[model samples]
Target: MVSDTEILAFFRGELSRQVNRKLQTVPLELETLLQDYAPADELPYVISDYSNKYGVDVSALDMRNYFPWENLPLTTRLFKGRNFRASVIANRKPLTVKMFAESARAGRWLYD
Candidate 1:
């Protein structure tokens, strides 16, 4: 079975590498938002890779729920106004390193 520590280490290393960021001396926690570690466009692939590497089933995982679409066009943003933008941001459910770790331990996706 994969331990949470192992899962945290994997994410910390993988995300740090992908983002070209330095590793934190402290290990990433369950609440650590995955989006903060990588660009929105890259998050899906990162999650997919993690799922595959650890044999976690991710068929139920929806990327849209966790990530907003890569930036809207300027025209759309302007027309949408502050409320629309705020709603979109508010609706995003944070995908965290802990969720992945839990799913890995369970051998399936655990979050909606």
Candidate 2:
């Protein structure tokens, strides 16, 4: 893996050039808080976790940063040179009172 300073500098330079903004990169600390909808330690790692810590101009939507390099397809097509996979990374909206109420209002659409 590349050094943190290199990553910081790259972000700094790119942001400065591309968006006319300065990039702020900070070291991750233990005091950082996580939302109930978010999971920590999940791999394919992530870049968004940094914005909350660094206050950088970039957010999770920046594909240059959040691109899931480790999530590449593990399987290839037969007799072809292609590899792909569909993965969904979403905020876990585990049933809360508000959501449960909305679902009840909508009625559970069960086929049976």
Candidate 3:
């Protein structure tokens, strides 16, 4: 079984790579939301890389359930309006480093 420390280290390295920043120390806490570290556009790629590297099955994971869309198209912005967009952001469940670590250890996505 992978220890939590190893899992966290993997995330630290992966996140640092995604953000193009070299971290000398733990830059992320277990509860830290991953969206805060990397761009939403890059988040899926990061997760995909992690899933592949750790053999974690993420087929059931939905990106929309965790992070809000980064950029809505012009038509979407106009039709959805600011309130609709705000609600989507407000209702998104946080995808934290701890969750990723847990999933990695479990070899599958654990959150709904």
lDDT for each residue of candidate 2 in 1-112, tens digit (9 for 90 to 100) = 3344543443333231222135544322222221222233331133333333343333223231223322335443323243322232232222212321222233431111
lDDT of 3 by residue, 3-94 (tens): 67877787777675433346445357778777666667777777888888889999988887776555557778778888888897888889
Count of clashing pairs, candidate 1: 0
lDDT for model 3, on a 0 to 1 scale? Answer: 0.77
Error of 3 at 25 (Å): 9.8
Clashing pairs counted in every model: 0, 0, 0
Candidate 3: segments with Cα more than 4 A from true spot: 17-26, 71-73, 78-81
Candidates 2 and 3, the one with greater TM-score: 3
**Model 1, 19-65: lDDT tens per residue?**
23464354457687776556676666777889889998999997777
**Candidates sorted on lDDT, descending:** 3, 1, 2
Compute the lDDT of residue 49 as modeled in candidate 3: 88
Clashing pairs in 3: none
- Candidate order by TM-score, decreasing, is 3, 1, 2
Q: What is the lDDT of residue 112 in candidate 1?
A: 88
Model 3 C-alpha RMSD to native:
4.0
